[model samples]
Target: MEPTGSERGPARYEPGEGCVTTVVRVPVRIVVLVLVVPVRLVWDVLTAAGRVVNRTALRPLGRGLAWLWQTLIVRPLVWLWHTLVVAPLRWLWRTLVVAPAAWLWRWVLVPAGRGFGAAVVWLVRYLVVVPAQWLRTYVLAPLGRGLAWLARGLGAVLGALVRWIVVVPAVALWRWVLAPAGRALAAVVTVLVRETGAALGHCWRAAGIISRALGRCLAAVLRWTLVEPVRWVYRTVLTPVGHVIRDGLWRPVRQALRTARETVRQTRREIRRALFGAPREPEPARAVVPRREPGGSGTRTLGKTSGRDVPPPARG
Candidate 1:
């Protein structure tokens, strides 16, 4: 159909004016189906990936990081901080607290030590050394000197007393006793000499008297005994014989003497005659001279004729 001009002009369905148009209407359910389903599927995939990362890789990484921080990083950092910072704080506290206390004690205690040492030295000097020195000076030295003086004085007094009392008396007594003995000896010797001289004088006189008496008595006894007896015998026996001899022999001798005298005269006459040649003449007889014996006064005649005058010799 080839339709002619103007009518054909616009194969249009006109509702009101001269324009040709087509109007299409969409469904709500179809829109929802396309957009909502794609968005939900993408969100689910993303969520599952996040869970795997956390479980397989991210969780282990987080634990290793925590261990490293505690052991290597965090603990070393804490030790370094204490060494560098906290140690100085503790030293400061000690210096502040203890140093002041020690200084105060030294300042207060030194004076007390010095005071105690000085007190000990003073006590030793006063109690021991001073007292010993005082005793030596005041007590011991004076006592020694006093004792020595007393001993010397006593010795001198004793010596003087012994010499005066004992020695003098002994010497005087000896002299007195010897004087008496000497006087007595002189008296005894004088008495003995007088007695001996008297006795010798008496003995000599007695001897002389006894010798004279003995001589007189001896002579008297000899005359009475031996001499008297011999005289008596001679008187008794020889007196008569002597008288006879004297008478007989003398008568003859007297005759012969007369004859001889006559003859001698005759012979003288003959001799004278012969010589003269003449007869001799006889001469006359001459007178004889008589002898005398000596007497007290003068010579006395001794003859028979004088017998009467002589008083006849005493018979003996």
Candidate 2:
């Protein structure tokens, strides 16, 4: 049979159905249908009656009541508000507040602010800027020049004294006594450094040979005592044991865990289905509506214009 509006969706899936559900479902469905038929019929009758009464009586009555409210109560209230409250408030704001504020800002505050700003500018220029300029130009400039001239003279004198007293004596001492001593010491040091370098090279080569032999002996001992045995044990014993445990014990435990998890999940789903109904299917997507161009009322003529084209009346 073709499905009705109420039965248009896909059928609900039953998971692992058994004997008890099959026996109970048909009889329960029959009893429910029988009990529901009269209630459904009564609901449909009442719904139709309500629609008829609303169309015939209530809609007109509501419209009449709305019109009465708009005419009697709303119109009078709006008029009273405009006359008693809004107009007086507007006049009071314009007269008492706006006029006084405008007069104060224009005649008193603006002029006073301008005068005070001018006075401050004049005071700053005279008391601060002019005096600072004068000091910089006359007093500080002359003082800096005199100090620079004195410093030049002192620097020249000090430079002459330093060159004669310290530089000359030091140069003489280095040239006469220290130069000969340093030359002799350099020659001795050069000979000693050459011999020392040769000896160090021989020692380094001998040490390298000794260290290579020692490293080889240690490596052989470690290979025999630790490395080879550890490698053999890991390869011969640990690898096979690990493989046995993985195959014989771990894999079965993992499989049992996975099966238990799946069983618990299925049980939870069944319990939820028993408590609530099946989850609803998603609604079908609505068809997209194409955009429509604005429609014209009629074809335009040469002399006639649309009402919208007329200019609004000018406000006074």
Candidate 3:
């Protein structure tokens, strides 16, 4: 057993070593001295040999090879491609395709487009739009006016004929013959209408009375049948049961959901702590812990100063 931080000051272990040096540190030092030193020497030797080879032979050889490849192979290929492939193709394309296209665009296509477009516009205005406007103004407009005038004259003649032929005879017949007959018929119709009106008034009164009774009955039926049943169900069944379920079931469900949410939140916090390391707890001010020397001798340090902000010492 060891004396922990609160129980006692720091102490040394057997074999004249502290607890860390005896248990954890000695093997580490031995492994480093025994294994790491030779490996480091071998690595240094190999790297030195490599550096010497590079400086003496390999560097110049690689630089010469690269220069030779670039100057002989790469530069010639690039020059050949530029001279034989690129320049000839560019010249041929300029002479065969681009120059012809430019000439056609400059001389033929552009002039055709402009000239034809303007000619088509003028032809359209002259042959179609202007002719249509001229026909409408000169031929169709006068023809339409003449047709309207002839139509108005014909209508006036027809209206005068109708007035003389139909309306004059009809007025004469009505004034001489139909007026007396219509008066006699209207007198008889007046008497019959009075009698029919009296009868219809009685029928209307009876219908009004019956309709009032039926309307009252319909209102009563609706109230007793639909309204009372709905009211009873709402008041007795729905509201009471709704209250019971809300308080008994829904309230507990909400509380359980709230508790589960809080539990999940706490679990997430714990998981985050485990994954990302512990939360940075507020620290107290630092103090140094030094080893106790034997036989009242001056104190000696086996490791670095112990403080909150002291960086870790170098490794083995």
> Which candidate, 1 or 2, has the higher TM-score?
2
Give me the overall lDDT of model 1: 0.67
TM-score of 2: 0.28
Give the lowest summed-lDDT range of ten residues in model 2. 2-11
Q: List residue ranges in candidate 1 displaced over 4 A.
A: 1-175, 225-242, 267-316
| Candidate with more favorable, higher lDDT: 1 or 3 | 3
Q: Is candidate 1 or candidate 2 better by lDDT?
A: 2
Poorest stretch of ten by lDDT in candidate 1: 17-26
Residues 95-183 of candidate 1: C-alpha lDDT, one tens digit per residue? 99678867766886677778888998899899988998999899989998999899899989998898799978877876798667877
lDDT of all predictions: 0.67, 0.79, 0.75
What's the residue-level lDDT of 248 in candidate 3? 99
**Cand. 3 TM to true fold:** 0.29
> Quick one: ranking by lDDT, best first?
2, 3, 1
Residue-level lDDT tens digits of model 3 in 65-148: 999999999999999999999999999999999989999999999989998999999999889998899889989999999999
Per-candidate clashes, comma-separated: 0, 0, 0
